[model samples]
Target: MSDMTAMELDEASGQAPRPLRERLSLGPFSDEWTAADWIVGSASVLLAIASAGFFGWSFVVSMKSPDYFQQAALANMPPKLDRIETGSIDVANAMPVPQIVRLSEPTPADYQIVMVFNNEALLATRNELMRVKVGSIVPGLGLVRTIDTEAGSPTVVAENATLHGAPATR
Candidate 1:
């Protein structure tokens, strides 16, 4: 019996040093992911998207609802003339008089409005405190004033105030 050469065997099998069927295949359906597997994967992705959308909608609704969110009391409530006091009067008119205002609560004053709507006057007495709420509007709107006196002397005067929100009448 004659010993066969490696070259002769390879030629007869039409293969060199590497095996013909030993390549690493990465194509679809090549022992990798099948059509059924891909379909299931897509369905899972859709379910995840749907779940996220539902959760997002619920979160938004909860945030908007006062009952769910628990509304906070206004910081500038129990409205004090000092809290929203006038700084410097730039413009004043007899008809719907306008004045510049600023909040002086918690230090560092901020300019806002404490308007005198419809010729309504705001008379403040010494030591007296006023509280303004949601339903505090004058004939024109966004007008409010309060006052009280502890000692013997107090004063009530109108300096034409301007406010950010709706005004309350006298």
Candidate 2:
């Protein structure tokens, strides 16, 4: 074995020996804090105390004059009614009656249904049937169908198709 000095051994071990005093440093500002650091810290403490005192004062004021606070809170609230009369004759008289008559069955000319696969085909169909008034759209089982009175025959489109442009599945 080669005779290695203490410093050489420490260097080989990836560590440098330090004196006790150097290793016992308190913290970053242990030596002495700057005047600016002291001023900023004092200001921060004072601001926190002032904010707490202001909140305490507000709480005391609110507790002393609870009625004032309550009035302030209720100032923008809706007025309380003495009694609520549901389905009353006066309410019925005030309401406007609809003139529409109920129909037993909807007419075929009222709506139409169109089926498409992807969003692009749906947009194209919508553009083509712009004049036709659509009622509602039902989407399920990987199929989308439109309900409208003036819609043409349903069309089915799929992303993956077999030979001759026919869908692979039924």
| lDDT over C-alpha atoms for residue 60 of model 1 | 90
* Candidate maximizing lDDT: 2
Model 2 ranges off by over 4 Å: 1-31, 73-97, 100-170
Best candidate, TM-score-wise? 2
Candidate 1 Cα errors over 4 Å, as ranges: 1-31, 66-170
* Model 1 per-residue lDDT tens digits across residues 69-131: 343346435655552264534355324646534342221122223333343334222322233
TM value for model 2 = 0.25
Candidate 2, residues 28-119, lDDT tens digits: the string is 77447667888998999999999999999889988898687778879979876644444335665576878634343222232233333332
